[model samples]
Target chain A: MAEGQFCNKSTVNTEEGIRHLLSDTNGKTYYKEMEALEVDSAAIQATFSKTLKSRLKTWLEICTHCGLCADSCFYYLANEKAPNQVPSYKIQSTLGELVKRKGKVDAKFMMDAMDTAWSKCTCCNRCSQYCPFGIDMGIMFGYLRGILYSQGFVPWEMKIGAGMHRVYQAQMDITSEDWVDTVEWMEEETEEEYLGLKIPIDKENADIIYTVNAREPKHYPEDIAEAAALFHITGEDWTVPSVGWEETSIAMFAGDWEACKIQVESVYDAMERLKPKRMVVTECGHAYRATVTEGPYWAGLKDGKTPVESIHYVEWVAEVLRNGKLKLDPTKKIKEPVTYQDSCNYIRNAGLSNDARYIMSMIAEDFREMKPSKEHNFCCGGGGGLNGIGRYRKQRDAGLAVKHKQIMDTGAKLVISPCHNCWDAIRDLEEVYEDGIRWSFLKPILLKMAIIPEHMIPKDE
Target chain B: MLYDYVTGPIALISLVIFFVGITARVVLYIRGLDWRLDRVTYTVNVKYGIKGALRSLFFWMMPYGTRSWRVKPIVTFFVFALHIGVLFTPIFLSAHNIILKEKFNFSFFTIPDALADILTIIVIVSAVVLLIRRLVLPEVRNITDFKDYMMIAITIAPFLTGFLAYHQAGDSQFWTIVHIISGEIMLVAIPFTKLSHFVMFFCTRVQIGMDYGIKRGGMKKGYSGQNW
Candidate 1:
């Protein structure tokens, strides 16, 4: 075969999609920023040396080019075997090129590298599982992101989000006052639906310090209301923090370690002051991973020495159900056949598959299992901050075809994803494809199905 | 004189280079370890990590454990057989054992001559199949380079020449000399080229298991229950 002739004729014309991306205003902004960024070889080398680990070196050396990992990549499968989109090819072209050049490449090369590292791949890590040697493509891409981030080549949306986190300590720039106001508003809204429901803010010594994605307040305030109703119904002492309320970490996704560190530290600082037994993060995949799995390290807290335990909201909900503290009303369960979208960070990264499934089973009348579910599930094409990066929407939408087919094959009326990013991406797919399928977060379904005992009900109601 | 040079001094030098080079490479790899002091700990179950490493080693050895076995069974079989032959034949072949016994008075378990012949044929055939694959498959061919082809040739030479010498199909002395020289070249090349995989494979697998098994706490009851 001719060189660079690796893509089959059947492959989707990704060039057109890329063209669409470049035509967008956000994409133009991203291009302009990348153009303005100075290409310094010394800086690139420093960042690479800093991020390149022994494990990554072994991974680079040991690949036999078996092409088996291609089967695991949704881009390869969905794009009709586009060789460039293959996981190995993606890594080899970007990281491999970087290593070969010793970080002395130019702007055009860095742009191509950024395209492959950021826009094309989602860093979901399914390829790592299929790799016989277990080369983690996700971690490798993360390191690549770090290198690019150090060079100031981050996408505009990611940069904005990270900047927001650095300034306001929350994604979407939700200030401390706005955060408290949203909580109070949700508390009142939830009180009208469920008597005596209160979305506590900055409650000291609470059992759980609840945190949420900023999207919960900005776009989907009902999620906050639903979570509040669940807490009130269960008679649990869970308080939303006035500060560090947003659990989502665009900084981590943007590969800004300093910003990521600050974002994680803010949450821990709030938890430390609140003295909560545990910090229960709302259903946001990257947020849970950032705070619970990666937070302590970023915050300079030693392993096993975190000030408080961090748990995903799904885990907390599952625990509540297991402890019999919350009862599910089967009669009030979601009547539609629902399927669960396993968020990559949650299932693959955090090993919370069982809890997610259990929560779905408890709330939904019929939970349809998508093919290749759980940790092996394909990304919603919005992972690794791709959903936040509007510049790559066309590529993101094209990749969503794989997820659309998976969801369609399940024949479920509603697909429930606990992750805000997955929910957003899947919702986009729903609209774009006109699939006539609704999507939701786990909080709404749980609130609707959970039964509160008569004694727990407010006396006035 | 040729035989003595090929089998004696050359052999010793190759062995020295192989051992020292591998040791140095391994040391370099260890020294290069980032240790990721800044990484947070989800869990530190070293026991599970050990178990997971052993499990991965075994799982990957069997073709059934990988998805490739189903998708590309022919290639998978050839690759698997190639690894078995290349790894086992060197230690177990009667001739190699005899040489070891003569040189260092070291001999281990020996495979029957018939089994050795079968393994030799498998190795030779698998090498050819792998070469054809490198030449034929578009994606694989794209990555294939002179070094890849040279590695295959280096691997195949000893077995091919050994088979010819054993059967006396060619001049026995010539075949034996070629075989000894080829074997020496392979030994010396192991630490320098793609052949390093013979040593690094275990290290890489174990490190992966440690990361996913111990740090991630995903390994449960000998199976990584994360996916299922």
Candidate 2:
């Protein structure tokens, strides 16, 4: 409630929010990428050169280092006392050096600045919380990262994260065929539990359009099965797109604004084309946050363009429970105590704090709160592509100590995190932080644990 | 001695400036119109609410908690020397004493006879050092905006007038008047301009004290110098 404090902690507190929101406008090369098939090599290089010079100049002139920005950074806190890691100080070292040198600085400076701007930062906006001056140092660094990204100066591992967005629009790189096959396969598997329940694909006039993060199709396909199972038990008339239903947007995180636009556009265009009554995004935090809160603004699609109603999975599940579409036995309970891990994007970014709790109450009996839970939740160490970098293991673990402590204090046998990044990040913390807690996504856990009355199960046979 | 005639106008301007300047500075602080020290470091409250605005306003007033104390060595030393000279010279000096008495009926604070002369000399020298540093240092040079360059210029004008008025060398009264008026103009501008960085500087140090002394936390923790 402090004057500068924001309810959207994920954007204002996390490195990705700091980097992505501020740096959203950085990808000027997106135009070039679109023209890459036609433009000559020299011209492309020249444009890049001009973009770098102009962006760097703007970066240098704007910043006045007051050091207030360093206070809230998780990385800054985790690293003991290093001045250079502070957002303002970090900008001063790289962009500041370039300004001081007037572009006379060599490639070595570029390389060094690139390393600090991209690899060292999680692009979380937590530092922005402490800055009294309203300097979006994360945005400044994000722009610089965009320029470096254009130059192929990013760490290779980070490239995979970006490339996943580039090739598949999701971090796990699921293809259209992969998505269809995966959903169809999961729907068939669910038939044993619900007779001939359907995972409707691209159904016209359906009440809701559903999207899943690529990670589900690629790795945790069973989680999608659980979601499908929930839909079947509720008899919800929802349809998943044959394609463009992948909701992860790494382009936003990587500072590639054009790619961000494209990824978001893919979904929006799909919405317009499909005209589903409402869209339900799966539990991936960033994608859901971006589609509803940020994508509309960033893509120049303001209040009018896509008012197709958007809801997160938590909201959808709560709707089913409230509507009595699904019969959930309140007497049904999990064997052990369970607690909810509020995804930063869900609680802070999308205002889903109550939604997660509401959904949790329907499924789990012993739901306990983590201290400073909901909007004030700490990021899972791997949320913002930190898990992608092999070298960041120590730093990631160190930054996650606060989260580990929160989880340990909960003393719950199960942790239900709704976001894939939280899922992976907490799983890593389980191994590294030694909490030894079993975890599952909220929707999946609910589907598996909740007792569905026989009347709710589809009589497809 | 005849310089008193010219200095009379400058002294009158200085007096007017003092009244108007203090009033304006206080008004801005009370209204929270001035930019906050935390804006650069914290998440600026972009939404509507009294709580967010007031929180920002509170920290803006007492920024000692947010700003850094590790002033660049040259910057710190010269700034300190200059502030002492500037703050003391106008109030304590005999030449100005005559004008204040004639104009507003005010006089020196303490040890005026000795301290006035010493403070005047320090003020003049420090102002010159500041001008030179602004031009010479690259990092400082990059950060210094046009207003910064002009601050040094404005600062020097008053001191020069005072110095000239002291020696009774040139239009002493006029120089004295110019010095007093310019000094007063600056006092009024202090709260509004980046010069209010003084407010932030003090607040930053205070915050460090509270954070370390009361919170009992390591005050200087941070990450490696990575860009993103």
Candidate 3:
């Protein structure tokens, strides 16, 4: 270890190390301690050597430092165009330098990497699209985070986040029993509206297997109930697995590859066991990105794909509505000015922008696009686990200005975002900016706007 | 003797080194790829990869094709102009072709002397502006290191010496020999230094272009436009 003011240092690759770190301190103390901890030159060099390859090496070498990537970054735009916020500078200073120096960096350099990795970037990949050479800072930063993670230079929430996946197979401590209970309770509670809403659990060979972010079960159980209500109205045969219900991977955000595999493998395991025709993940962005795209590789599947074909919530809902399985009440459509928040994980990263916009057209009468729409839209500011990292609260909030201004410019009071992360970001942005903005996840908005069938309507109503 | 050795023997050695080094580096880069890193198959269409690459390569080359290009109109204009001058001036200049024809009995069609002069001046002026931009811009300066400065200096050296030699600046023979040596140094440095981007740019650009075209741009089998 290079000499510095060494503090709470632990080998976090082990289960015991993660357990100790999670129990002993919170996000703030852990961050403070990690910042002070000495840099492990051996660990950095080992990880760097392992990850160094043709594509990443070329990306670092080929960068011309043209600085065009600065405008594409929301952090740069939101931070008054800070020079440090430039995507090229941010990646080059940390990951690029690490490769250049063969990872022989000091404590000061590691601390800089820690701050820039978690706080400065959310891994939105917007800059990736804008780059002429297609140098993805998001991918580079992700690789950088793994190296940082090996040395235990990680955010407190992210450490706990990966631990949660390792322990409970969810981002939170929601057991299989708890998830089943929540679905049953939601079915009963929402029955008053739909009369008979059934949330089938672990039903083998169901046409659709639905998964959700743990936050839905842990914080917003109503989201689960609302999804149940939609499936009920649409008359689709969907079942939620009691064992692998949670789909979001905080481990992916933390660059903890082991925890990522654990979380994604559980879901894949359920799919293989039950053999659903297709899987529909809830309105979560990163969850969809993880499962649909990245998870197959993490799980080491032969085809590099999930066992069953899976689609996002918006993809399923839009198809259902378009094919006339479910109808939207024209009279009940939102009349107020509304805008759509594009989730980087799904909308940009997954090319679900049009699917989301098509849903918006059906749900809202007065839909407006923010300054940039579709794949060109900026990040929601609270992406890549930044929303949950307490140490970066100030920077995260400050970064919301670009998004806040985008919404204000649209003059939309209601924002319809299809992804859970985007929903949280918009809600938080409205709360902090106090622009009198209101927001919703697609589940609630779909439930409110989706017309109930004549037969399924409540008897009393 | 110095001029003859440099222009005749050393120049040939530099060309051989340049070509062989590039070939070896390309092979090493391909072999260095850890298949485990890319074990998972990309969902995007492999067929459109080349098409996408060409699209982005030429599109980015356009004066205002990208948002970044549009953002700074003057920089875009200057960059494209500089590229044209740098690439064309040396190849089309009549003096260089005469030397090539005398040595190898083969020469490319040459431009008029005055046109060559104008292009040389443009490249020289652009190099100076680019150097100043690197020094002055806070963001660019922050990332710029001694190596970057040295690379920039090496790139401009041949152009500056060629311009002086063409104009018969004091001791024309001396200027011409120095220009030949500097040009050869640049050729040898291409594969070893960051100038590898001259070749690797296609690889990086095409890979990303394919990424956008197949995966995120929704060119998959079932999911087409509007359906996405």
Best by DockQ: 3
Candidate 3 chain B: 10-residue stretch with minimal lDDT: B219-228
Best by TM-score: 3
Report the candidate with higher DockQ, 1 versus 3.
Answer: 3
Question: Cα lDDT of model 2 overall?
Answer: 0.59
Model 2 residue A169 distance off true place after TM-score fit, in angstroms: 4.2
**True contacts recovered per prediction:** 0.42, 0.02, 0.56
Better of 1 and 2 by lDDT: 1
Off by over 4 Å in 1: A1-30, A304-306, A455-461, B37-45, B66-72, B217-228
lDDT of 3 by residue, A66-168 (tens): 7768789999988888898999999988987877787787667877897899999988888876776788898888888878876777777787788788888
Mind giving the per-residue lDDT tens digits that candidate 1 earns over B179-218? 8999999999999886888877777776666655544435
Best by lDDT: 3
Ordering by TM-score = 3, 1, 2
CA lDDT of each candidate?
A: 0.77, 0.59, 0.80
| Chain A superposition TM-score per model | 0.91, 0.79, 0.95
lDDT of 3 by residue, B1-228 (tens): 898899888999999998998888777766765434643234434555455566667777777887667767876777777778878888878988998899889999999989988887787788778778888877677777777877777778898999889889999999998899999988898888877766776667766665555444445344442111
- Number of the candidate with higher DockQ, 1 or 2: 1
Q: In candidate 1 chain A, what residue range of length 10 has the lowest lDDT sum? A: A2-11
